[model samples]
Target: MLEGKPICGGVRVARDEPIRYVCADCGHMTTTRTGRCPSCGAWGTLESEASSAPSKRSVAARVVSAVDVRPPRRLSTGIGELDRVLGGGLVPGGVVLIGGQPGIGKSTLLLQAAGRVAGTGASVLYISGEESEAQVALRAARLGVASDRLLLCCGTDLEGALQNLWDVSFVVLDSVQAMRAEGEAGWPGTPNQVRAVAQRVVDAARAGDVPAVLVGHITKDGRLAGPMLLEHMVDAVLTFSGEGYSSYRMLRAVKNRYGSTDELGVFEMREDGLIPVEDKSGLYWNRSDAAVSGVAMTIALEGTTPLAAEIQTLAGPTVFPYPRRTARGIELNRFQLLTAVIEKRCGLPCSGHDLYMNVAGGLSIQDPSADLAACAALASALRDVPLPGGSCWLGEVGLAGEVRPVTRLGVRLREAARLGFSRAVVSSRERNERVEGLEIVAVSHLNQALAAGLSRKEA
Candidate 1:
């Protein structure tokens, strides 16, 4: 009777009014009383839903004789690095959401995993909402995915895609933005549509006891492009991030209900596909034929794996009136604080110089254990002296110039030793800390660390 569609049986619901009922079978919303859903046409299926009110129905409880305490088996993605980042492997009925910048290889990685899983005699469903089947096929051919068990479904309608999901062990939704749910009122990629599509996919996967991977786009500021609850609905959130110009990519779990968030997976892009970098330290440490000035090595812990990275710095006279400070792969504020500590405590004046610092190999270092190495690099560049060969630094610098002890010192030192480092400069405050292969050079302050790290003349 009104210009707008009827909410129930010829009942006009205002646009601003709250919805009072939802079709339990079809998930259609309505504000008026109706025996049949207007969208799905189901009789007596309209359920009364309240936004803020609790249910008045009676509650029933059941007693269980015993509980199944067996651990859920994980399906390996066939890539050791990916499997490691995913807490060993994918669990059945679990949903994983991966977000990354465009051209960051999110789709490539998922396709690779699907191919690998399908190789093990498991049926894999790859739902492509963004790319055509031909495009995915061409890419899969290039990646050498010739598995007959890997099924591809290219469409935007979630209901249409669900029809092909039967008898599939693994499912991959290549992008949630391009998918639309049936009977949803919003356009594709909107919050409502995304929520609906995700809910339906997750419910279907859970009912079939299958694991699903959902690809999501990132906003301009590097956040998942969807409702915040989208993350909560999934079992894990993995972020694939890297520099656009750089070939190195990192896969880290932001949230994992089944595994530890501290784990990280490293990969390098190639002509075939992404290859996991097993020698992580070799990727970051620049193996120079000879020792170079303004360079220092430090061991950093990314989750449980230890990584050795080279820190390089350049300190020169500033042409402009104000001195300039720049940092790459390191925090600017951390650099500023380290410079101040060097000026105040180490007796090295960086105030009038333009200081530039970088972590070698595009490896972003967030751990404070590299602080001593950064300070050492800055000091070496200022003095134009090369640090000793076969040595690694591990300590944090304090405001008072003290070399603070770092966590997992033994693990870091062991990694450095395995990499053939002869000496490790650590904090003197560490009690009875020593590694078997490397000699520990304990220092109390930044000045002492510089003296131990740099050549004879600079010290």
Candidate 2:
């Protein structure tokens, strides 16, 4: 007989039972051991552990009225860009997991935010398991973040860090992988330990009604270095990304429970710390009046923010049988598709020429609206003719080479006009709304757009 009374659906198992295996990479559990995880296909990731029966408790279920539910108020992180990406600000009891490559300024951004929140007369706790107190202090000093209300703790014991959660209004864990729970099996950074640490942090934040941010690491594939379950357990998942050779950094949300994930935050790493960039277009646009071959401008929208970007391409004769196609800041497949479109639809000789493309200012754009600009740049380079000065392209090219209307035409044109652009090439199907100080050149086909935008003068 069991020593303790069994509750409803709660059963005690015998001491001898089959051991279970759990995948360390994807958090998959199975009674049978396996060499690779069926979920994520990662080999040698399954770890053995004892299996335990789950207790099923029966409790009264209450259905609350939707009218009684009120949205939680947000606490500002004192950084406008960060706040924008976070869907306005951090909510009480919300857990945010932000991941990035090493040396991407995750700690610096959080420390600066903590300092700012502490400056507002609210206590903020910063817990670091990866760095020593002195190291963090030295970096904090370098960032000029000195606040009495900002408390610091350095340790891997998650329970010890949560001890101060109730005393603080905001909390930050430098990294979840570096922290461990009291009774968790395996070492820190293991799948089990990561899950345990995240669960503990989530529970503590919910109980204390404080906003918490967890810094996470990214794998070589640019994915968050943990089980998929870690992302689901958090309220928001943000990615801080930037090129190693560039000072610009972009922060965007992959998941947000409280708000929209369309917002983006731009920052520049400076001597003091990460500074928010107000004029994002200036970073990508060269404001030059000189018309050069192989260069075309476009206004790409990052969320609601419109940025003027320059796309440059080069086309030269190749000696090899198969000409090389190289692209940076844009997908190679997309570039190839556009090259094929230009060659077939516009009658451009791209089959024998080596093509190279890049987005200016080290900004990676996924917006399809820049398709027209890319095609125009490629055409201009191949023809050795410079595109018209003060012109912007806004359209999506189809496989048949037809230019399709893009969303937010007026927004893109207005941004172009603001940057002193005089003309914009757009799809003929789009409504011709007159933007102030901007002329719209609508074309139904890529051929028409190329003919209209490219100047007769050769480079």
Which number leads on lDDT?
2
Candidate 2's C-alpha runs over 4 A off are: 1-19, 48-57, 455-459
Residue-level lDDT of model 1, residues 81-107, one tens digit each, is 888888999999999999999899999
lDDT per residue (tens digit) for residues 312-392 in model 2: 999899999999999997899999999999988888889899999999888788999999999999999998888988888
Instruction: Mark the 10 consecutive residues where model 2 has the least summed lDDT.
Output: 1-10
Task: Report every candidate's CA lDDT.
Answer: 0.88, 0.91
TM-score of each: 0.84, 0.91
RMSD of each: 7.9, 3.9
Instruction: Return the lDDT, model 2, position 281.
Output: 96
lDDT, candidate 2, at 233:
91
How many residue pairs of model 2 clash at the backbone?
0
